[model samples]
Target: MKVAADHRSGNSFLDFLLSFVADCSKFQSGYVALIGKPNVGKSTLLNGIIGQKLSIVTAKPQTTRHRILGICSGPNYQMILYDTPGVITKQMHKLDELMMKSVRSATINSDCLLLIADICHPPEQVLGTLDEGAVNLIKSKPTLLVLNKKDKVKQSEIQKKQEWYEKNSGMDEVIPVSAKFGLGIEEVKQWLVSKLPLGPAYYPRDIVSEHQERFFVSEIFREKIFQLYREEIPYCSQVNVVRYVEREAPAKDFIEIEILVEKESQKAILLGKEGKALKTLATAARLDIEDFVDRKCYLEIKVKVKEDWRKNEELLEHFGYSGKIASASL
Candidate 1:
């Protein structure tokens, strides 16, 4: 009986030692920045890779203002994805400059890069789209040229574009994918895993992102603005969550939001005739917020004129554009 008990203890110790060795030897983790021009589906690919809508997506260009972190963790790896603002070569306003700075910050922090391109568009040099400040940094890193929107083009066109990027883009690899349709996404993931350095997991295995709930709530409202409005309305607008309260089950959560515009004319347009437009926006935003948070909530929206806020560097920094990329707009 004593020998039998000793044998059982030895077997248990061996199992524990093997488990620890497997966990230590197999882990891979690193930061990856998704870089591209406006409307190139960077956010779409991020959402596809993370398998969740962490970054907001729209048909309009320059929808993402800040650098959002989307964390995807598997059993053996954790990929921290930076869904960055579209890098614009032209710096028109203080906000645009700050956004480019955000892009640079993400690029510097990331271990590798995903330089996305639109296959539907002509085969232009991907590095040419990044600002001069970020070009050298991108070149220094291992970059994968993701030719997105492959679903929109024919198979032959896809092959031609893929070959073109491989020949001219100077990227480590060229992957043609339809981020919107979930095609070639696994290849993208596999490439990322290979590039990521071997290390311990950066986040818990079940966690998907590090952003606060309020940041995403504001993004949801901003996305509705982009979808429902036209012309300069979405571009000139900013959404901020003023107050968020979590209540008990009998009472719904409470959220108060503000939308900032540059002019009274823009405010009037946002409100629409007799406030009907704002009501439509609120209803749409509220529904999406409920879905995002997985709970019912009361939403209050107000439109204010900030008078060229985009040009105001002080205000732009206050909105979390300069350095604190993930700060929730208070």
Candidate 2:
């Protein structure tokens, strides 16, 4: 018997040719916006789907303040996932409006939307229902009802929430997933791919996100703030990377970061007794920064009291939260 060297057979040359042909076939690519209320695991879900830490995840709400784009490419599909800030219930400061604007911008022109809801809450809770802003955003999009944190809820509760969303919300599909544990993520990816139109890859296959290293570096420092602080401290704080200097081989990279707070008391709190707190925070952040840049990092963190910085338009823009709501309007 003669062995066949064809594409369908176990032939390396023919297999490579067939794979190339498949790559050149019609590919699905589009932007998907992940919108939800605070602590709904939007960041976690995005990181889980993309298989990287593109968005910072903390136990606190509103950790994501801008529109973050994370790209995930497969053999035949490329998903540009937009992880926006959580919907703000009350626009307290200019920063709040800016965050909401990000959500709006992310929703506009998106190929698909994932409204992630926390299923662990009871149906009567606000978490059970989508906010007006979210509802309006979902009305005209190919939306998917993603009930995240499925691991925290019972099967009966999951069914109830899914049924409620299916009836009350006009989502095309309802998926239950635990972003932390990676359950039902494959289904989420499949649904996103199904909704994407046939097109060429939007970004390079190896690229995970469009943000530069400084953006992620700032987020890492902010994540530490949220992790270490309590009450209104984290919410009132913002991290700014003033100088990020990279040196050649055999030289350690230096990063100078400033943590801005609204009051001197907050600044003192951030510095802690004899700057011990800041030192601990810097050490923790440096370890992660080293891992991210794959180099030895010397991180310098300072606390500054920028009184009412959240309300200052110039400062907000400097902080990169210039409210661009009008630009997002359709």
lDDT of 2 by residue, 197-250 (tens): 877787888899887788888888888889988999989988887888999868
**Per-model TM-score versus the true fold:** 0.91, 0.87
How many pairs of residues collide in model 1?
0
Give the least accurate 10-residue stretch of model 2, judged by summed lDDT. Answer: 321-330
Give the residue spans of candidate 1 off by over 4 A. 1-24, 131-133, 325-330
Native-to-model Cα distance after best TM-score fit, residue 57 in candidate 1, in Å: 0.9
Q: Which residue runs does candidate 2 get wrong by more than 4 Å?
A: 1-25, 124-136, 323-330
For candidate 1, list the clashing residue pairs, or say none. Answer: none
Give the per-residue Cα lDDT of candidate 2 at 12.
72
The digit string of per-residue lDDT tens for model 1 on 180-204 reads 9999999999999998888778787
True lDDT of residue 235, candidate 1: 91
